[model samples]
Every structure is written in C-alpha cells, then in structure tokens.
Target: MTKIVVFDSGLGSLSIIKAIQKISKSEIIYFADQENYPYGKKSQAQLSKIIQNSIMLIEEKFFPDFIVVASNTPSLMLNVTTKKIFDVKPPLQDAKKKSKTKQIGILATKSAINSKGLTQYIKENNFSKKFNILKINGSELVDLVESGKFISNKKYCNKIIKKVLEHRLSQNNIDVVTLSSTHLPFLKSLLKKQYPKINFIDPADIIATKIYLKIKNKQSKKNSLKIFVTGDIKKFQTKLNKIGIKKKVNSLSS
Candidate 1:
C-alpha cells in the first residue's frame, strides 16, 4: 500500500486530507499537531524550528512515502519541501488566470500575509505586471476552524469573516481569492454566501492531483486512514466527532 503522512498545526490538515482521499486510495496518516496550534502566529525563527522538528518526528514515526506540510503559514515562511515532502503555497497563477478584474486576493494566515517569501513567491509565479495581488490576514478565520467554531457557530463565523475580509475584498474589487491556508477552505461556503461575486480558490485539489499522479499506479485498493493528535486527545476527538469523523483518534507519542 502507498502510505502518505499529512499534517498541520491543527484541524487545517483535514482539508488537504479530504482532497487527497477524493482521488487516491493511499493509506493516509493524519497528524494534528494541536500542541503547536496556530502556526500563523509564530515568528520566522520559531516556525522554522517547529516545522523542522515536526517533519523529523513525522519521518521517524511514519516513514511514509510522502509527507505533506498542510499549512500555508509555515509553507510560505520557510523552505521545507524536499523530493518526498510537499508544502502548500497560494495558487497565484491560477488566481491570475481566473481573475477577470486582474485583482487577486490571497486569504492567508498573518505570518504568511506578512512573509517576504510569499511576496517572492507571487513575483515568481505572476508573469504579468497588470495583475494586482492583495494579501489579507486570515488568522482569525483559521482559528474558527481549528477551534471548531466554523462548524459550531455559523453566525459567529460570518461575523469574523466580515470583520476580517469584507472591507478589503470589496475595496480592492478582487474577483478571485485564494484560500491560502488549508484551514480557510472550511469557510468557503460562508465566504461565498457573504461575497457572492468573489471566486474563492482552494489549492487542495491541485496538491491532491499532483500526489495522485505521482502514486496512481501504486495506490492500494482500499483507502485507509489513521488519525493522531499531539495534544488534548479528548478535546480533539470531541471536535472531530462534531465534524462527523468517527474514526478513533489516537494520542501521538512524544
């Protein structure tokens, strides 16, 4: 069976995992590093260390064929990807192509929004000088998903979404917004409801397609999943239950 390990600071990993499962029958090991919740708040040095340690631990523990760093915060802030390791980045090229207004928005965590790497990445991917890229800090929205408020409280989620996004998106005339953080996709429905004209793009499917193409021939007949959390197993399990993930969540060993 093709074994793949996917992980992020908290519930954000579920978005990427769900996308991967849709196309491939690879055995997935999902690690929710709750102890390091909100990788968006970490400083560049802090995030570098946290991501390095997490990747090392995941490699030592699972020895999977591929490892996905499912959070855009660390993915954009640091150089973490290798041959087998994959990191999520904002899909600026896709946004540019789809954007009729030539104004594209990147809804990412605070760190990613402010990261020089993100700016560089945009410059590298964007071939046209005509397209304008707006970076919106979506850390609060990411918190909603990690804390299970996105599923539990739609009213509150809408409030936070408006408070965080409405003004900038409306002012910039951005027709397309990239859900740069894995956690942000959970709010897609609400975001669309709020801003009907905006096209929210999720990079998960693109990432999943890349993985599927890489291991399509070796995929197992059955899709199996194992979930683990690094902190508060009971609380994390409760959150998972609310989202209809009944699979047992094991405590990740230190």
Candidate 2:
C-alpha cells in the first residue's frame, strides 16, 4: 500500500484528502495543526519555520511517500522554504503550467494575501505580466465553519460570497479563482451558485492527482490517515463530522 500525508492548519485540508481518496487506494494520513488554527496570520518567516518543523516531525513519525501542504498560506508563502527543508517539490507546482488564462485569483487568508509570496512567484516566473493576481481573504468564513455558525446565518454567508465575487470582478475578470485557503473548499456550492461564470480552481484535485500518480508509479510509500489537533477534541470531531469525515481523531500539543 502507498502512504500519503495531507495537512493543513485545521479541518480545511480534509477537503483535499477526500478528493485524493476518491482517485487512489493509497493509505492516507491527515494532520491538522489545529493549535496553530490559522497559518494565514503568521509572518512568512514564522510560518516557514513552523511548517518546516512540522514536516520534519511528520517525516520522522510516518515517513510518508509524499507530503501535501494543503494550507494556502503555507502553500503560497512557505512553498520554497518547505521544499528546501524537505527536499520535495509541492504537488501544486505540477498543475501550474496547465493553468488557462495565466490569470490567477486567490481566495485565502489575510496573511497569505499580504505575504506577496504567490504574487512574487507569478512575477518571478514572468506569469505576472500575463497572470493577473487577484486576492481575497476569507478567514472569517473559516471561523464561521469552525464555530458551526455558517449554517445559522444565510444572509451572512451570502454577504461574504458577494464580497468575494466583487473582489474577483474588480481585480481583472479572473479566469481562475484559486481557493487558496483550505476552508474555502467548504464554500464550493455557494461559490458556484453565486458566480457560475468564473471557473473556481481548488488545488486539491491537482494535489490529489499528483499523489495518486506517484503512488501508482511506485514512487512513494503508503500510509494511513492520522488526524491530530491541539484544541477541543470534541469540537474538532464535530466539525469533521459536519464535513462527513467519520474517522477517529487524536489531539496533540505544540
């Protein structure tokens, strides 16, 4: 069996894991650094160091065939740092060339948008000229999901969706809206319903497909999905249940 690890700051990455499992039979490991809750608020240096350390820990414990940095903040900002620390290319990089219109609009956390990492990458790759980078922070929505408040307020949800759409339209008529934050995946239906004209890009598919290919090619070992958190275990489990993940969860400290 092949082993793959998927991680994010919290339950958001579950969306990625779910997609991957649908495509492959590899054992999966899902880790949520819930103690850190939101990686978006951290500075690039801080996020890079924390994520590097976590990767090292995961490697020592599971030695997964491949690791997916499912958090947008880390994926966009600490990608290079993580690669240097772990000596692996992130799966999302494989999907970059396939991007149409070259214009990428990212919906992520405030920290990710402010880090300018994705913007810098696009510019450095010369995709900046062709790629119009539009960014919107949806951290509040993450909170809503985690707190179980999203379902309670339809008006609030619509307001947020409208705001995100407005940002996309004002930025450059984006061809691709990258759901940069793991939490944004939970908003897929709403996004599609609100803005059917724009194609929403969730890196989960690309990342999951890459992992499946690697496992099929016998490039990585197989591992089981293990979840860890640093917050209320019951609350975390409730959120996971809400998202349809019924696996047992574990709790950890920083």
Candidate 3:
C-alpha cells in the first residue's frame, strides 16, 4: 500500500482527508498538531520551526510515501523554501491559470494573508501584472468550520457567508474565488448555494486530485489509516464523530 501522512493543525484537515479517500486505496496517517492550533497567529520564524519539526516527527513516526500539508496557514510557507518532503498544490495556482476574468478573490486566514508566502507564490507564478487579486482574511469563518457545526448550522453559515461575500458577491466583475484555506472547502456547497454567480476554487480538491493521480496505480498495496493528534483523542473523536468519523483515532501520546 502507498502509505501517506497528512499533517494539519486541527479538524480543518479532515476536509483534505475526505477528498483523498475518494480516489486512493492507499493508507493514510493523519497527524493533528492541536498543541499548535490556529497557526495563523504564528510568526515566520515560528512557522519555519513548526514545519521543520513536523516533518521530522512524521518522518520518525509514519515514514509514509507522501506527506500532504493540508493546512493553508502552514502551506503558505511551502513556496519560500524548496522543502522536498511535502508540497501543497493550491487551487489558487490552477485558478489563476484557468480563470477567464482578471478579477479574482483569495479568501484565507489572516496569517496566510500576511505571510509573504502569498505574494511570493503570486509573483513566482508571474501573476503580478495581469490579474487583480483580492485578499480577504476569513479568520472567523475558519473558526466556524473548526467549531464542528458549520455543516449542520445553516443560519450561522448564511450570516458568515454574508459577512464574507455580500459585498464582494454584489460585484459582477469578479469571476473566481479561491478558498485558500483547507477549512474553507467544507463550506463551498453552502457558499455556492447562496451565490451561484462566482466560482469557488478549493485547494483541498486540487491537492486530493494530485494525490490520487500519483497513487492511483499503486492499488496493489494494502490500505490502512491511522490518525494522530498532540491533544485529546476523545475530543478529536467527538469532532470526527459529529462529521461521521466513528473509527478509532489515537493521540500522539498514545
């Protein structure tokens, strides 16, 4: 089996897990560093250290064939250096290439917005001149997703949607909105149901598709899944159970 490791800060990465499971028979190890949750508020030096330590920890523990950094806040740091073990195929890259309109919106966390990584990725892709990029900090929206109620909570989603999109959705000029955070993809259906006018790009889908393409031919191997967290296993299980994840999930300390 093609063993894979998924690294994230919280339940947000579960969205990534959902996508990968659809097309791959490979085993997956989900490592949730809840001890370092809300990666948005961290500094560049701190993120650098976190990413490095995470890579080392996963390598020492899981030793999987691939590592997917499903957290957008952390993935923002992927571009600055050439870290070979893990990479994020963000939809923003694909959206910039495929979208027909010049006006585009990137909705992510405050950390992602402030990270020079966004600017670096944009310029690295030569998206500096032609496209008008609108960056929005959807930090509160992320909290809603992490709260484990966004799916069942419509009124809350609607209110947050308005707070997030009403002003921008009113404009006819924008064509695509990239949900840069992995957490944001879970709310795409709700967003689409409300505003059918603009297209939403999710990095989770893009990353999952890429992973499938890489491991699709390796089905001859057996598949397995294990989840790890730096915090309470019961709490993680409770959150996952709310979303129908009833399987056994162990804590890092376990």
Worst 10 residues of 1 by lDDT: 123-132
User: How close is every model to the real structure, measured as TM-score?
Assistant: 0.98, 0.81, 0.89
TM-score (C-alpha, index-matched) for candidate 2: 0.81
Across residues 18-52, which tens digit of lDDT does each residue of candidate 3 receive? Answer: 77887667788888888787777788788878888
Residue pairs clashing, model 1: none
What lDDT score belongs to each candidate, Candidate 1 first? 0.90, 0.68, 0.76
CA RMSD per model (angstroms): 1.0, 3.8, 2.4
Model 2 gets an lDDT of 0.68
Q: What stretches of model 2 exceed 4 Å from their correct place?
A: 80-104, 128-131, 150-152, 167-172, 217-224
Q: Over the stretch 116-204, how does candidate 2's per-residue lDDT look in tens digits?
A: 67667555655436555666677776776666555667568878778656755656756667677777777777777877766776767
Any idea what lDDT model 3 has? 0.76
Against the true structure, whose TM-score is highest?
Answer: 1
What alpha-carbon RMSD in Å does predicted model 3 have with respect to the real structure?
A: 2.4
Residue pairs with backbone atoms closer than 3 Å in model 2 (clashes): 2-222, 3-221, 3-222, 3-223, 28-224, 28-225, 29-225
lDDT, candidate 1, 142-246, per-residue tens: 989888898889999999999998789878989999999999898999999999999999999999999998899999998899999898999999999989999
Worst 10 residues of 3 by lDDT: 80-89
